[model samples]
Target chain A: NETAKAELGRATWKLMHTMTLRYPENPTQDHRDALESYFYLTSRLYPCGECAAEFQQLLKKFPPQTSSRRAASLWLCSVHNEVNARLKKPAFDCANLDATYDCGC
Target chain B: NETAKAELGRATWKLMHTMTLRYPENPTQDHRDALESYFYLTSRLYPCGECAAEFQQLLKKFPPQTSSRRAASLWLCSVHNEVNARLKKPAFDCANLDATYDCGC
Candidate 1:
């Protein structure tokens, strides 16, 4: 179960980080809305109830930043570091986020 | 790029299917709303622009089914099949969905 949970977390984080990295540099309001709503809804519909609740709390503390691709990606990177801290994982360097994820798109 | 896109697709699908399978058997209206909005927002924010547009079109035609866990999972399976067909991939057997994905949560 722990393995599965960990795998799911990694997969979800991969998708989220890639999405933000690919987000438009100068997004329209609709684009921003979509990204913001996606995260909130993800917190609600995530498979693990406990994890979902924790994410909801995190969102409340640090709402999603959707101003632009860089903002969104960095915001997500910071948030991910918070989760990493809770899990006793090493902090990910937020500075090299662009080099970190490649969606191959 | 194609490899990254395919991997992202696989991860996203795994999370989505797992989440649906774990959905409340008798969900509240709020739960239904969350699931529905998640799909819509996902289509809008998907990293692959072409894939996102295709999904948005599919949503217009099929919409999301959020009445219950069974309904939601089956609906997603069917939608996924639609995608598989377009991509010339083998159709997934939807009969054993509960056995197919395990989040270990």
Candidate 2:
């Protein structure tokens, strides 16, 4: 029984290691969309609040470019959801899910 | 069960402090492509033959990623894997999954 306990302990250890990931359960349809949204946002790396403000302004400034305008929704959400697993914070709140990104980031 | 074995050994020390992640099972991709690879390369800093060869050549030239590469994988397959448990690696390894990293930097 001790031997089996040891073996089960070892396996649990391995799974815990897997959970360190910061995002979501991932590889899901929603997870994929969220990741895709995140990649685009991180790629943008808007350097200032003005850039973010300008992001929303563009639609109003040039309402004709609807595709870019539509993308803003994904951008807002991806920017909000947050994860600080290194912080051992709650794991489910989608870090890149959108406008919820905390200043604690 | 030993108070459920200290809450299953602190939940198996938080699931072996999580398999300590590497180059797989991540968000669809990374930002820098380089980070898409490994910030720590705890995964593929290279197992050796060129860069891995020079790693092989360099390590064979100089040999071993040293206190470094190749065998950390071949080596760590220990208590977590076999024969090295009495070595009580994870009592240390429980806090150490070094060679395996999110590497995505």
What lDDT would each prediction earn against the true structure? 0.92, 0.30
Candidate 1 lDDT score at position B92: 92
**DockQ (Cα-based) for each candidate:** 0.83, 0.03
Q: Residues A1-105, candidate 1, lDDT per residue (tens digit)?
A: 898898898889989999999999999998898899999989988998889998999999999999999999999999999889998999999888888787767
lDDT of 2 by residue, A67-99 (tens): 332343333332222212322444544344333
Chain A of model 1, TM-score against the native? Answer: 0.97
lDDT of 1: 0.92
User: What would the per-residue lDDT of candidate 2 be over residues B1-105, giving only the tens digit for each residue?
Assistant: 234323433443232222222212332333334232221221222211122222222222222111223232323333233322433434345234543322222
The TM-score obtained for chain B by all candidates, in the order given, is: 0.98, 0.21
Each prediction's fraction of true contacts recovered: 0.90, 0.04
